[model samples]
Structures are given as C-alpha cells and as structure tokens.
Target: MTDTFKHRGLRQKLVETVKAKGIQSEPVLKALGKIPRHLFMDSGFLDHAYQDKAFPIAADQTISQPYTVAFQTELLEIKKGDKVLEIGTGSGYQTAVLCELGARVYSIERQQELFKKTSKFLPKLGYRAKKLIFGDGYKGLPEEAPFDSIIVTAGAPFVPKALLKQLKIGGRIVIPVGDDVQTMTLIIRKGQKEFEKHDYGEFRFVPLLEDKN
Candidate 1:
C-alpha cells in the first residue's frame, strides 16, 4: 500500500524506458506513470517492480511486461470513456491502465484464483473495472459485447472468431496469436463482416486457456 517517492521515481524511469522503445502515446504513458505497479505484486518482488519486464505472480501468471502492455494499449488507441473488453485479467495490471485512461473496462479471467484475488484487490487501489468475471477468455464476454476495443493479454494459437464478432463496427482488437511464441495481431472491424488485420512482430506470453471454467 505504500508508493513512496523512490517508487515514483523508478516508475518515471520505467515510463521513459517504455517510451524509448517507441511507445509514443502520451495518455498511455501517463497512465502507466500514474499506476503503482510495484503495489500490484507481492512485496518480495518490490525490487524488480519498476523494471521493464514481466514477473511471476500468483497462479503461475506473469504480470505483463511494461513494454508489452504499453504496446498493446497504444495500438488500441483508447479514448476516454470507451467500452473496452480485456481478456486475461492477470494481476489486474492492464485493467488498471485501462481504468486510469477512463475506459469502462470489462475484463474476463479464467483462473479462479487470480480472479478472486484481483476482484478484491483492484478496488482497493481504486482501479475498478465495469466488470471482472471468472470465466473462459476464449468465449469473450458476449453478454457485454460490441466493445469499442478488446485486448487479449495472453497468447492464442489462433484468433477466436467469437472475439472478432464482439467488436462494434470500426472497433479493434489487439491480440497475440501463436503458440510457444506469438505474433502480435491487430484486427479492426470495417463493416458487418469485414475486418482489417495487421501483425506487429514476435513476443511471448502465457497461453490463453480455453473451456476450463
């Protein structure tokens, strides 16, 4: 619960590190700077909190690397008050960034342990999403579909068709599609049945598990 001046300084440095890597979105960078990432992890890992890398968290999930979070969030081009769907609420770090940007975030986490922990933890830090459900990320959140944007935090072997159908016309999804390694993919909805796709190089992430709920 303590975010000291030292921690703030470290976060600013981390922000600059992410910026140096080509993350130019001011709003996204500002949100990253504001959130206390160290507080999201256990105190034992406090020393590594502000570094530009992911670290293990509960339930074997890693809080995403800061650069990866920034890259995906920047690609989404989040606008204030946009309805954003986040798949994989691991550590609630990405969800906090979305909240800081004023997006109405609906996040789904399949791991019950992480879900319960995060559901209770996020509000304590004042990063409250619109909803946090313990369910299969593969299914997306159809009941609350037509999101302005969707972000999948884990690697998927292929883009789930259900997620593609959940976007509003002109909306976009930023997902990493692959197996052991992933190709960051961005798909933008053009019309009722049209989508524009782009890939942004390679990265690794925990696999997005399906149907284990």
Candidate 2:
C-alpha cells in the first residue's frame, strides 16, 4: 500500500473540521489523520472517502460519517490499551478507529456479507481484534464479557440491557438511541447498579436490529 496519507489535504481538513466542531480529543484526531479512509471504501468512492458525509459501502450499509465517528469516539474518553466492544461493525471504519486508539477491539456485525468481507479488511488496515463475530449484536459478545468501552454504530430504541451489564464499572458506552430521529447517547456504567446517560444531539442512522444475517 502507498503512503497515501503523508502530507494529505484531507488530514488537514479533518483536523480543522473536528476542531471547529469541538472535538477536543487529540488521539481521535490522530487516528482520523493516520487512517487512509480511501482504502476502506469502493474504488469509485475513493475521491469522496475522506469527506465528512457517510457513503454507501457493501450490503446497503454506509460508512459512518467522519464527524459522527469522531464525536462518538471522543465520548468514550479512552486511554491506552482499553478493551472495546463494538456493535454494528458495518464497513469496519469505526472498528478500525477504536483499534487505532489502543483498544483490544471485539466487533460484531449483523450482516453476513459485511462481516465476512470486513473480516479480511481489518488485517489489511493493520488492526487486530479479539474476533469479528457474525451474529446479532444486540446480544453483544457474552463470552468476552466486561468491556472497558462499548460502542454501538446503529440507532437502537434504548441501550441494550445486556450491553449495560457487560460494561465494567466506570466504562463508557456511546450509542445512537431512538426509533426515529435518533440522538447520540453516552452511557457510563458507574457501578454494578448505576449508570449515567448523556445525549449529544440528534443523528440519523440505520436502526439497530436483531438478526445474524
């Protein structure tokens, strides 16, 4: 692969865009800068891969818009070597970002084609995960219980109870919650019985569903 990101214009734009929008986390910006988004998208989309808008990938799914990805990633407040569980892997773009932030990622994708295909792309992007599961993400990764952070890519009716259970104390979960016109929410598990929820703002996303394929 070429060093396409070195001295790239998009990286500069990402820095400016996130900064203008109040994305305060430096590591999140660094990951956005370093990741070559063009590689993850269809060749036809190479021209717009680095833009802030979401674009279609395989299986009728779109890569998360760069701003949304940055917003959610920053909400996690991650440090080095955190264990993150990602529900709704989609194009694996957000999964790659979490991995870049020094998280041991375990990503679950509901679409069989997306899971099968992105399973290979992860390595190509230079990120390793505990596993990429082809399953209903609503259930989460039970075998790998207790994630330091959990991020859900799709919009759900509410934070899944199982997911809240899996978050270790002080762990943060960023999710999109609603049936229509979802709001991006951050859920912090403070203890075995207490959790705090914060809503960032309205967002439109494909609804989170329960199915393996």
Clashes of each: 0, 0
lDDT of all the models against the reference?
0.96, 0.87
Model 1, 1-213: lDDT tens per residue? Answer: 998999999999999999999999999999999999998898899999999999999988999999999999999999999999999999999999999999999999989999999999999999889999998988999999889999999999999999999999999999999999999999999999999999999999999998775
> Where does candidate 1 clash, by residue pair?
none
Q: Residue-wise lDDT of candidate 2 within 94-202, one digit each (tens)?
A: 9889888998999989898899889998898688887899888889988898899999999999888999999999999999999988999998888889999888889
TM-score for predicted model 1 compared with the true structure: 0.99
Q: TM per model? A: 0.99, 0.95
| Cα RMSD, model 2 | 1.4
TM-score, candidate number 2: 0.95
